[model samples]
Target: MNTKKHWAVVVGLGLLTLSACGSSGGASATGSKTVTLVSHDSWAVSKNVLADFEKQSGYKVHVLKDGDAGQAVNKAILTKDNPQGDVFFGVDNTLLSRALDNGLFQSYEAKGSDLVKPEFRVDQTKHRVTPIDSGDICVNYDKAYFSKHGLTPPQSFDDLVKPEYKNLLVTENAATSSPGLGFLLATAAQYGDGGTSRSSEAESGGGWQAYWTKLKANGVKVVDGWEQAYNQEFSGSAGGKKAKADRPLVVSYASSPPAEVIYADPKPTTAPTGTSYGTCFRQIEYAGLLSNARNTKGGKAFIDFLLTKEFQEDMPLNMYVYPVREGARVPAEFEKYGKQAPHPETMAPTKIAANRDQWVKSWTSLVLK
Candidate 1:
């Protein structure tokens, strides 16, 4: 969900009014009719769909596009006492605990909570956040690069450490990017926490830390965020093509191939990129009413509107994420090119929260050093 910013084509939606502001600015004044929504840069909605919400609810929506998901969440936490907007969106499962621990949101059960898929729901008792969309953070390969090199793209995490695939992969910094953290968590899930009780040949007896060490040895490149990894380093993306990027593999979304196809000029008959489904981690994004919001009522209404069928159905192209609402229809391109991973690696939020900080510290020492 964080790297959804890679789909740059959908970002220019003229109908939705936006304010490019940081968390410290652009907050709505008290008693104002405008309800501001602060989110990561990828947020988008069709003009008519957003118009429908405003016309029906009589509350004008003003969106503030913060940086990426990680940056936005950190900024929101710093400003929780005086938030930038009424509602905050783009906090994903990877960072949900941080926001919750800091008391960034006030609980409010959305109107159509029952419609959300059961698997995506979390914090059921508190209702501090509402599940909005889900996607898989995965490794994407350049089709042409593999074909031209007579190289079979790496399929799984283990394959990456093999000699043949060395120097062909790039990923974001785990401490600063959602997809990067997801990939790190995926390895931690695949190989247990290096405890003696879970020793196995697949884990190489040292667990995720060992895995990352091997990945670093294999020449995996690390960038600051998804945009740099996908658009500037990955060979298959549209931005990468213009930039003449050389890395054939990048950590991005399963939905990336469809976005490539859909945005190409003369739309390709088939996607130029493909996902390595084996190297995927599930990611779920959420939205909530910011604590100390000026327009509590408007914030509640907007959160409810997000669960509506119209908004859910409009998400695929706009945000490149799957709606969490059951029975929501995805675009044809998504179905054909970006089917969800059958068994994406996942870790419980509790496990992630308990170990995330240490893992990042270890990762920085092992990989970035």
Candidate 2:
């Protein structure tokens, strides 16, 4: 991949760490004391966060910005034998299977990982891929649009395709967008008979296909990326013009609501937008130690540190991603600006690992072509 028609930024942010590891390959310490963190561009936080971790632990940190989720894992696998970075962060459920099956991660669960939400915490293969944080990808409608039009947001996948919203909604292509893929998986979960991912063997694949056809028939303006789909396609931009600020409704992570407020210019005391529609798809993200790591002990500590309260709480505000911790408090902007997706879509990593390429290719040929 060229990412052929995908929301490059969403895929970049969502799967950032999964892209590649070993950027500064083999920059490990002589003894078992230092650690190299081959982080993705999406693997970010206040610089102080990393510094605090380093101070607590004597391990010297070597950090590098690799590519996105898939690329990071790809490089990790390629360099498995030589073992470039000690630890990798933010390889989510979508790429989990490939990361694990390729034998890229070493087994080491974090401390107090047992208290994490069961689904988010477990790496069944015993590979111990630690769940760092999780969030939902759902349909977000501008509150202004719904209120102004005297209409309610779509409650289900089918609601989106109804006549009222024929030209109002915008979505990214699946092959190129992580949010689009998340939306697709949600339909599979709803229609695909409760399966999270649509495999060839999955009966839900038909249901997923049916829903997509209906959505297509409803007249969605398909775009290649989330930025175009959200910032430009949806109505309710300050100008509300497609070319000017077209995207109002989009496929995005649940954390976006808070992100909007957090990232807003000059730092607003309150949020500027509202995500009143809770049409979200739950997505769980994980971190794994490259199968061949330069410093195994250091890798384990870094993963554990990611789960700590400081990191978990800092996640929502800094990275605009939710924390995996059971009782994390959301920022004011997140609670007010962000809304939840009640019925999120899901897919097991294994299923996605098997069919992602084929499905993406078919989708490209069928629709994007």
Candidate 3:
């Protein structure tokens, strides 16, 4: 959910081009049959998933878990001239345009690409990336804490800026976290401060910056990334126990409460928390063959495997994300507790790509500074 990583693409592309081109890192295979898949830390698969892929495709699979979506994509781009891995996964809609524009992928046209649902199939023109999963970034509130304080959960973006909610919210920095960027985008769309035309200044005009100014005055706590905001600060999550953070509101996924149940110490009969549907921000993840792969054939095969029923079916419970492939079964935990918004805010990839950097800049000035 860290869309903030894309800002690096805007400023670091030139350096990446030069540095990557000068290296021969991924040109030769270290092991004849081994094919590496580079992905973000959040990516997860069943224990034997790669082994199954290896058995089916006759290729040894190595997964390199990078820092986050933005970091992974940026690393891929920086190494595009000589890719360190054969395939790259975890570039979401927010970071998709930057990855595509940087020419980080090679056209593979994996056979199972058609199996993806129409709503999730984002890359039609170029066969560079294939949709694999989707999720909703939303604000999750501490059910127990809110009830204890006799305070109602915020119902909308407007409610967040109210005096009653002061010091009760914590969000990741838009410059470093994907969900942070997502929540910022939701506010931008809600306030008419998004898109390329708007300036990133509070005094210069009314837009995302102005909205952020009001949020800052409401005593919002801004952290570096989702891990800190959700795990260290949000009172609802067990992770908050580590830091004793009592902030009841945080930016997380709609499916997070269900995930907590699924991964609980003693599996819970029901979810212990809930998410605010009003804050949902749709994020779609994609995978593609990195250009100049040492094992292009294996890379294409891996992408095909990703879209197959086997991999898709393993996604929901393991990764806490919805599979993009049609006919993939949804886990019962998801059906029971995962919240979905009736109408989550959305912005075109083009507009987001064009305005993302400026919006983050404005948000930082208004909120962080």
**What TM-score do all the candidates reach, one by one?**
0.91, 0.84, 0.88
Which parts of model 1 have CA positions greater than 4 angstroms off? Answer: 1-5, 8-25, 28-32, 196-203
| lDDT (10s digit) by residue, model 1, range 52-153 | 999999999998887677767777887778788999988888878988999999999999999999999999999999999999989999999999999999
Clashes of each: 0, 33, 5
lDDT of 2 by residue, 1-369 (tens): 121122122354233334333444365543577787765556666678878998999887776556655566667677777766778776777777777777877777678687677767567568558888777777666666677779876765666767887766677777666677766656656666334433442334455665566667777667765666765665643223436654456676665555655544566665444543435667777777776676888888888888888888877665567777888776777677765555566677877778776766666565555
How does model 1 score by TM-score?
Answer: 0.91
Candidate 1 has an lDDT of 0.85
Residue-by-residue lDDT tens digits, candidate 3, 267-341: 878776788887778878888998878888878888898988988988877677888787888888888898556
Candidate 2 wrong stretches, greater than 4 Å: 1-10, 13-22, 25-32, 193-206, 235-243, 265-278
User: What's the lDDT for residue 364 in model 2?
Assistant: 59
What is the alpha-carbon RMSD of candidate 3 to the true structure?
A: 5.2
Model 3 ranges off by over 4 Å: 1-27, 194-205
Cα deviation at 91, candidate 2, in Å, is 1.1
